[model samples]
Each structure stands twice: as structure tokens, then as C-alpha cells.
Target: MSGVNEDYNAISSVYSQISKLPLMVLERQLVAHALSSCKGQTILDLGGGNGIHARKALELGASSVDVVDISSGMLKDGKTITAASGVNPAMIRWFEGDISSTLAHLPLHKSYDVILVGWTFDHAETEDQLLGMWRNVTTYAATGAKLINTRLAYIPKAEETDGIEKYGFLYPDYKEIPGGISYTYEAFTDPPLRCPATSLTNTLDFDESKSIARQHGFRDYQVVDSEQMDVVKEDPAFWRRFVDQP
Candidate 1:
């Protein structure tokens, strides 16, 4: 399987486990709060793995959500979970493709009121690629729309051991590439698979990300760190450990 596919496949299988962690739960809460403020009826979940955020949007009264991801396995798992949870499956539209291409061709009655690019834009390998992603998002965003993105601020220089113990995954290899950092992990699969998780936006800091958003015509961009969120601030040690890799 391709790198992204394999990693996400393994991730989907353990989605339930990892998502229970305080860090992950806090992330979701923060995102949900952001969605609630948007008052958006239509939402676009870019790189939405297993409809996690999509379901939240629905719970917050979003009429419909379109989930676009590169991993079909993740989407399948998400569909099953959401259906089981009693969310109308029809309310969530799943698309399996790259975000850049998928958004360009997605057929919708109107532009999306809220666009959630959660923890996905860091995959872009270059400034141009990151800008392209914002442009693609802009193509589908309604006027006076809001775009919220969450990304890792810094890549650790060393391998992490605690992630495997806590989340059942370990990034054992770290390499500094041209644009960002590359991490290699051996995900705990039914039959284990080697997965390389790379972040191409390693060079993009908070200011740069906001600048890119502005260049693409998105205004009032705000960058919020997890530490600043009420849910995460309560447990400084956990978040500090999470951000500080081994």
C-alpha cells in the first residue's frame, strides 16, 4: 500500500483507541467549539478521518457535511461508526481523493459555509503546495466563510517512544528533508505495516501559515495553540510531553 494509505489504514483500525486520549479529546473539543461559532449549515471536512469531526458538525446542527480524504479505509470505517451512532449516513458525503483535486471538482449546491482543514495541511511539501491547498479551499468557501486549520507547530528531532505506549504507535525515524520533516512508524496492525508519515510544512510556522491564508484571500486568520485552550491548559504536563517528543 502507498505510504498515506497504509498509515491511515492502520490509524483507522486504532482510531477508537487513540481518540480516547486526553490530548485527542481536547483537540476534538477545541475543533467543535470552533465549528459551533461558525453557525454553518454546510461544512467541508478536509482530510476527515472516519468522520470524527463531521459527526461533531452534525451534532452542532450542521445540515450536511462533505468529508474528503485520501484513505478509503478510513472513510469506510467512519461511515460505519457514524451510521451506528444514529447519524443519518446520507447527511455525510464521503469523497476519496486528494484535497486539492477533490475540492476543485466536488459538486455542491452552494459553497461551503465552514471549511475544516484539521491537521492535514502540514502534509504539503512546499510553500506552493500549501498555497495551492488554501487556494483550492478558497474555491469552495462561501463569502464571509471561516477556515480553521490545526497543525503541529514543530517536528521533534528525535524518535518518540511514549506514543507507542500511550497511543500504540511510535515514530522511530526522523529525518530533516528539504521542506519539512519525515517520520517513519511501524503501526500496530493485525499484520504490522511500516508507515512513513511526513510533514511537508515543517518550515511553515504560525505567522507563515496565516500569511498564506491572507494571500489566498482568507481574512482574520487566527492561530490557537493547544496550550491556550481551556481543555488543554488544565493538564500542562501531558500537553508538554505530547509536544516534546522523545
Candidate 2:
């Protein structure tokens, strides 16, 4: 499930339990691939919840990491976790701001080496709002910067959601909206959490993002195949359903 502002404030701790899921394990592998060459790079993690991926970037040698999200509660949780761990929390800066809008005027650096937008776009409620999130990404990116992001690629039918719960979250109760669709993304944390989300029809194929990035001067956008990932290749059967629906 994507962390969209206030939706996660009360359940932030419950939300972090997603790390124990198999699909999340593979997803982290993808994130590790994106950050593999991020040593010495400055990074911006939009929609970064509790500094999870932000800390990973720090471990991978990021000189600085700025985490921007809309939830003050989640931001507080990040600082708490960092403080408890007693790591270089000073190296990572946390800011409470919305990525769908309001990131440009914030005191953020304009050019980052790598920008990570982890599942933020799916929360866009309209076309303009969705594009607003893209605007933030491009506005802060450097001229040769790489962007590793997750867009809502597909909205599954309720019937197709049968076996996805084991992955820690299941999006059900699909409802068609003006631009695309809306659904409830339920994370199977001990005491579950739900977030109503939207995904645009045009954006479902990922072309909307590619075009936006290109217009902003990015060179390329490639969709990496999970099947080729070593995590999945090692045991395809174990990750079969997730690879199919993820």
C-alpha cells in the first residue's frame, strides 16, 4: 500500500510490518538495485515513510538524504526510529511536505543525484494532482539525475484479488472514478489499515510518467522486469503470484 499523508499517522507502526512480507522482500531487492550505484550521491526520497529507504540510501553511501512526506506523525516516527538505532540520523533530513504539491518552495536542494518516489503517485485523486507530483520530481532533479519510482501500473478487479493478501496488502472494492479508478488498499498488519487510492487510466501503462520525465529533460525510463531479479530467479515458484500481480 502507498503511504498517503494522514492515512498512515495512527497506524505508522502497524504499517512498517510490511517488511515481513515476501513481495516486499522482492520490492526491496528492486530498491537495492536502484540504489546499488548511489554511493556518494545526494538523494531525495519523496513519500518516504519512516525513513526506511532513506536509511538504505545512507548505508549505500549517500552523502545526504532528504525525506519528504505529508505526515508529521510518520516524520516523527522516522526520527524516533533513527534515534533509537543511534545511527547517522543527522545525515538524513526529514521534512513534512506533500509531494503531490508543495515540495518546490521548500528549502530542498534543486539537483539530486537520485530521486526515489516510492508508491506516491497512486494516491493522486485527479489528473492535475497527479501531474503536480511529477512536477515536484522534475523540478528538483539534476541534469543527468536518475529517477527510480513506483507508479500504479494496474488496478485489478476484485475477483482477481483472491490470492494477493499474503503479500501484506490487498486492493479491493474497485470503483470507477472520473479519470480512472478508486479502491481500498488494505494492508494486513495485525490490526489492519486501509487507504482509498486513485490511479489514472492514462497513467496505468506508465507512459504518462515517461513523457513527463522526458519533457523535463530526463534521458530514459526503463521498466525493470522482476523475473530477471535474482530474488525471483532463485525461486520463481515462491514468488509466482506476486510476480504475476505485483
Best by lDDT: 2
Give stretches of model 1 more than 4 Å off.
Answer: 1-3, 102-104, 126-128, 159-170, 185-194, 225-230, 240-246
**For model 2, the run of ten residues with the poorest summed lDDT:** 1-10
C-alpha lDDT score of every prediction, in listed order: 0.70, 0.80
For model 1, how does the per-residue alpha-carbon lDDT over 1-246 read when each residue is reduced to its tens digit?
Answer: 135666677667666555665656777877877787644479988888888888888888898999988888899899889889988888999988777453556665468888889877756655566656676688878898888777656555454354333434455578877877777654454455455656665324667666767877887876455566776677767567654431
Estimate the TM-score for candidate 2: 0.91
Which pairs of residues clash in candidate 1, taking residues 3 or more apart in a chain or in different chains? none
Best by TM-score: 2
TM-score to native of every candidate shown: 0.82, 0.91
Cα-based RMSD of the predictions, in order? 3.5, 2.4
Over 126-234, each residue of candidate 2 has an lDDT whose tens digit, in order, gives 8788778878888888878989887667667888877666667778889998988889888776887777778777567667667866776776777778898898999
Clashing pairs in 2: none
